[model samples]
Target chain A: MLALRLSRVAHPAVQLRRLAVAAASAGTGFLLLCTFGYALGEPEHSGAAVLRLSWCAVPLAATVYLALAVARTDPGTRPRPGLSALGLGPGRMMAVSAATTALACSLGSLGALLLFVQLRGGLRALPLDGGAARVLAAGRPLPVPATLTLLVLVPVVASVAVALSLRPRDPRRPAAGRGYGRFGAYGTAGARETFGAYGRFGARLRSGTGPQAPAAAEGARPASGAAGGRTAVAVPAGPAPGTATVSGPADALAPADGPADTDREDADGPADAEGLGSEADPHRPPAPRKPPAGLPWGVAVLAAGLAVEAYTSRAVTLSGPALSGTRTGSGPALPGGLDVGSVPVLVGWLLTTFGLALAGPGLTHLCGRLLQAVRPGPLRLLAGRALMEEAGRIGRPLGVVCAVLSGTFALLVLGRGPASALGPLTALGTLVVLGCTVGTLLTAAVEARQDRSATTAALVRIGAPGTTLRTAAGLRAAALLVLFGPLTLVVAYLSALPLAP
Target chain B: MVAPPDNDVLWARALHFTHNDGSPALSGVSLGVRQGEILAVGGPSGSGKTTLLRCLSGLVPAQRGEVWFNSTPVHTMGPLARERMRRDRFGWIDPVPALVPELNVWENTALPLMLRGTSRRRARTAAQEWLERLDVGELTRRRPHQLRQAERQRVCIARALAPAPTVLFADEPTAPLHRADRAHVLRTLTTAARSHGITVVLATHDAETAALADRTVPLLDGRCVRTVHLPPVQDTEGRAACSLSV
Candidate 1:
């Protein structure tokens, strides 16, 4: 009830975010219920119905994940500093967040139920519309138990996900500032140390006490107070053996041997990465190192997928000599079917998609490097850097979208017609899945943009012109399209080729 | 160091600011800065150093104060005018780098120039020069996440200096750097400001940083309690050294 009240009184932006989550849930729920209704209609093909319903779960799951992300970043829902003093601790705040998420999803599920029941006719009878009766067990009664089960699925999954993602870490640390529970930079060295790499994924996301800049690094020079009057300026250490002093200031900060002057690895790359020595080392100077070339794991997975597809494309064809006296009852095997079986083909497609997804971040990083390899202008530099920074955030979503497109393309090729062979219900299911996945990816991008807002604001304050930022954003989009657009087309075409008649 | 001239580039009188929560951030604070002069605002945390800097730079208008930038009344200017002034005449460096994580050191440094509609080639060239001047030229290809704290702060200083703003507002710009790097960056900043004739309003807690300034104003509880002037130090050649690397 408190969650619902808070939703009512929350900032418009927070409310809007929740509304989107609710809407997505409604769409997912509608799809799931439709699948369940179809199952009721076709009790004879109950196995197929179950499979279709399971497919519906994919989009529903994506929606839940997005909803959880939104909740984590919602400013109105975040616990403020001093709230714990009022007896609302981190533990209580987390519960509030989870409850709020559950309420939003439950609302969406209810919307889906109402819409489904209305579209199918009324609650009085199972109203199958648009000749769905022909494909389903048309005259059969709708099973209440089955329908209720499907309706509750979204809320249950979403709430549990919210609970798991938002559980409190250490209660001792005060809930302080912005960027807590946020997906990008935690901003505080303390928070970064406590949460480690897991914080970036919205896991153990800690809110800050306020919008204060993070305190300086631990064990460094202690900050001089007002009483430390007129302290002498620190003298620059002599340059290492071979280095020459340029301008006094520049010479002072210059690393004698490059970025390796310090033993501290914490400041090296991303907080999560240990050694990316070749790429970021300032001492190496000129020649760009080659990107890691071995993709043996991807290759092995791709080969396995190809073998599966090939076997499935043709039936079990047995040689007469090999089966001479082996089977008396079942003599010779003529090519059994066009493909080994739909199940094996599906599994192959899944493996191929997973391999591609795994390879996405590395490929994106390479694309970033390529952008700056030439005579990079300001736009190219900005775009390239952004791609490198956000490769992890956006890569998986891009991969998922690519996989869906490729799978749809292959299926279309196998059918060899503009008319979808999967039929209307199946087509609708696929659409929901693809659409929700893309939406989830877009939400991630939004979160990333939010993470960069402070930097943007700082730039603006310093008199950075607006066009520079806009151009940078445009360049990023363009570069991503240029790189991924072709890859998607090629993967779709190749995957579809094997099944072509 | 050159003696401060009589003419003031920026002057603020009787400034007052109250937060939305009713906490006073600045209370009747007043000061003046000469062109090419480096003025330091030294205080403890919450002593209103940052608030004073923001008010004088036209980032936040004080509810009760008169701010003049070379005879133009800054406090009375509209939002667009203030923004235009910031874009064209002023540069700011925060305590933290606050660099755009997606941008490399050069691109981040050149951002203000690019935003001002300078050609891509020109902006990048200017950015590269500043990066070299700050000794971070080799890391031009590196993004913020790829840099150490000191390297990142150097890039921030380069970005602020590249545009050659009339006045620069730097709030504890050396907070993140190690002791050695801190002196170097401060020297670079003071040298650039002097060479370029850019007025500097620096806010810091470090006495070393303030000692390099032409004058230091101590703020306490959002009010200026006192001002101190330091005698310029002379190098072996008998030239007055205004730099922090004494």
Candidate 2:
């Protein structure tokens, strides 16, 4: 009851996102009902009927995952501090989120059922196929129970998935700040303390220490604090520039290495002479350290996966005469003439998709670094930083979109290969799947934008023109497209080459 | 009431503003800021310090008073004009820094200049100059989430100063820093303002922060009660040890 009431009072944006989820659900429902119709149209081929229904599951599952992501990011659904005191903790909030999702899916399922009935000449008559009275189930009527069961499957799977995904964890392990990695919020352990301390296998370069390349292996160097017992080396948040460091009672509580080193280091830095002049007193400390950079190993992994897939498909094609009639017991292709190696190829494609998702954050970080590589104007800086910050949140969704794109292209190529290969139902199924995947990617972008409103407000307050922000947004989009567009085409071409006649 | 001086860079008369919750945030507040001077707006929490600063900076227009910037009535300017004025001629520092989480320290500091179409190299060079001044040059690559509260605020000050605006509005800019750090930040801020000929309007409840200013306007119940001018301190570096009474 609370969930229903809250849904009505929620923000309009939340309502709009929920509507998108409902629309995707409705599309899924329609596909499932058609699968059932196919079953009734050919009850004798139970295996084919089951196969068609199972194929519907892929798109159905993607839509469910998308719906869950939308729910998780919706600010209206977040548990408020007051709500916990009112006996609505994270567990109750999760239940409410699931309930809301279920309600939307159920509405869509109902719409599919109504549409199916209307198209089938009401509940009383079965439409015959082109005067062939024996083909459209002939005398076998559409089983109401079976049809209802298939219709409800989408809603059931979606709601259960939502519940499972949103269910509260132990609540003891605190959520990581900034979405990824083990770093706690500032002053605890930042990216510097984590990857830098661990001496990550790549992307580390030692400057000023010597002309030596950093060790390629993770174990080549001692941990950051191993030698000096420099535990908790707190870099004092020094007084602002141009001011003398003030020693006071508050200094006692700071960790041992606070501004004591800061004043000295401030004097040693070269830029100090120009900006601070002689006003800032001099002291000495070790040279300042640069932030850590992680290697983009994920990209290498994805490339290798695609290359292996291409090789496997070509090998299969080259020995086609020898392998003819050697089915490998993977069973017959379902209506589309897919080969026995289709399952393994599909697995390889999935592994590639995962690799792309994993590589997304690092590539995004690199994009940010490169955008500002030149003497960056403010516009480039803002955009670059935004890309780096949001890489984790949006990267996986982008990877998913790429995977969908490749899959769609490959299917289109395969469809043209065999006559009667692309049926009306199959085409409709393809459209629904591709559309939902794209919609999911767009929803993730919206979430990233919402997360940035505060930063936007701060910039505006500090005299940043709106055009600067718009330009930055445009730059980020262009950079991502420039980087990913060619890569997507290359992968699609390579993967399709071996499969095509 | 004493008339605003002819040389005042910013002047406001009988300003009034109300919050969205129907509470009055400012009432009949008037003040003037001299060119290149640090004017602190001091009051306890819930007082009109922030509201007055926002109104003076043209961030929020007052419904019932005149806000004149060098003979131009800021209250009557359109939004685009006000935005342009802010972008080109004013700077602001919020209490919590509020740096863009995505950008590292240097990028965040250089934003205002880049927004104005400054060349990337020039803006970064200028930004680095200030970052070094603020003693955070080494952490230029660290994002906001990685910095402690004090580090973030210092970066914000550098960002504000980088633009070399005519007037800088700071609303409790050092509220999150420890006493010693706050003193240092304030000292750096004032010295930089003085050297650059930039006018500063600082809002704070802390007497120490208020003491760092050349003059102070005390607010009570959304209205200015009095203005106090402090005598120049002989030892600027030792002013942190000086006792201040509100």
In model 2, the Cα lDDT at residue A126 comes to: 45
- For residues B120-237, write the lDDT of model 1, one tens digit per residue: 7899999999999888888786657556667888888899889899999999998766789899889989998888888999999999999999999999889998654456764555
* DockQ of the two-chain complex in candidate 1: 0.24
Q: Model 1's CAPRI class?
A: acceptable
TM-score of each: 0.66, 0.74
DockQ (Cα-based) for each candidate: 0.24, 0.28
* Candidate 2 lDDT over residue span B1-246, tens digit each: 344578999999989999989899888988888888999988899898988988888888778888989878899998788899999999999987787766667778887887887776788899999999888887786556445566778889999999899999999988877888888888889999999899999999998888889999999789888754557766667567675845
The best candidate in terms of lDDT: 2
Candidate 2 clashes between residue pairs 3 or more apart in a chain or in different chains: A241-B133, A264-A283, A376-B120, A377-B120, A378-B114, A385-B102
- How badly does each model clash, as a count of residue pairs? 11, 6
- Name the 10 consecutive residues with the lowest summed lDDT in model 1 chain B: B234-243
The candidate that wins on DockQ is 2
